[model samples]
Target: MREVRNKWVFKKVKVDVFRVVRRVEELMRELNDDMSVAGEQEVCSEGGGRWLRPEVGWVKLNVDAGVKEGWGLGIGAVCRDSEGAMLWGMTEHRCATLEPSMAEAEAILVYMNKARRRGCSRIVVESDCKVLIDALQLKTKGRSDFYLLLDDIYSICNDFEIVL
Candidate 1:
């Protein structure tokens, strides 16, 4: 009778432990879901909506950049018309590694230059990097490492009617 009682208690403890573990896993999943939803909402609000269509007679140039730890950086851009049709797209890999922000700045510079070479006069430049946009708009000449790149971008802006 004593042996049976001990076995029953052990089984009950094991089941309870598993139940607690299952609850923890469920909570973690819920937390991750909530975080992802929040992130999506933030992006939507910042981006002004999904797939922004450019104004009439203007081409939308969207640029993005990514950095790998040991590897260098990759930059890409897509130019689309008001009808949401892709006009041009390009991707370039930089052999020199850089910080994420610098990589983003480089992407804008490269894309704008390419567009200019392609004779795109009127463009709406779009980037997810709000900091870079704000800096460009405000003309903030800080002593950061991106200052030179920002200057170059401003200079490049002179070649076209650019709307950020």
Candidate 2:
């Protein structure tokens, strides 16, 4: 998808113009929606969203995961440095359907592990799931049924400096 946009694939040819345009437009919308740097807010700060940069030397990891009925789960993340240069991005499909919070928590934990391995000492991780975000912010895991998963996430988080 990045290749189609970044490499100017559209500029190379114009095929079935209207169909191509509509397809590209739909793809654009999906990508923008997938970026999900901020939830329930505009894409820019002036419009009340928060796709802001991290401090220099820090990487901002934007993550999101979703569970679709009968379709299992999808998890993805993109990491960009303070300069807005792409460090990495990934998407995965899990065949098993899982609870939403569990899937989101698992996604973030996986992203953090990858980021730490990528040598990102300081990171600002962003996610659209308010439940997971709120859970991570609290000092304790609480008495939720998924507390053990939360515990695992917190332990992995200790490997680096993290920003909510």
Candidate 3:
């Protein structure tokens, strides 16, 4: 009876290993396809435009947010002058669980507040978040959970001569 149980356990372990290997292979293939598509898109878009420096005497504040499952969000910003010299950079991690859009809004709010505190009067804000940018541009108060954050961003914008 003990020998039979050992054989059954060994077979189960082998089957589980095979299933894990197959799943990993499938995931690898999917990732490879995604990389290829992203590479092609980058090549196509490279000729469209490039990142230009801010105007003379103005500093650009670029902000971005990163989110991970089971981990909170991270917000980062960098201030650079027209000569491409870094004036300042900051990063902060928040313990709250937030969606991507909300995290982006939070990043913008944090960076703008930091810039204000640093006495940045003439600033150009740049972000890859089109939704947040559009909301700020149109002054649209979104109905989502980010409404308060968006409002805060709008209020902060009034503090500086901002070019979005």
Cα lDDT computed for each candidate against the true fold: 0.77, 0.75, 0.75
Best by TM-score: 2
Greater lDDT among 2 and 3 belongs to: 2
> If candidate 1 were superposed on the true structure by all CA atoms, what would the RMSD be?
16.0
Model 1 agreement with the true structure over 1-164: per-residue lDDT tens digits: 22332554455333354765577467545544543565432223222466556777889899998777666788999897765556778888789888888888999999999999998989999888888999888877967779889999999999999898
| Tens-digit per-residue lDDT, 1-164, candidate 3 | 22332554455333354765577467545544544565432222122444456788888898988776665888888787765556887888788798888888898899889989999989999888898888888888757678888988888989999898
Clashing pairs in 3: none
**Which 10 successive residues of model 3 have the least lDDT summed?**
39-48
State, as a TM-score between 0 and 1, how close model 3 is to the true structure: 0.68
Off by over 4 Å in 1: 1-49
Q: Estimate each model's TM-score.
A: 0.69, 0.70, 0.68
Q: Give the candidate number with the greatest lDDT.
A: 1
Model 1, poorest ten-residue lDDT window?
39-48
Error of 1 at 106 (Å): 0.3
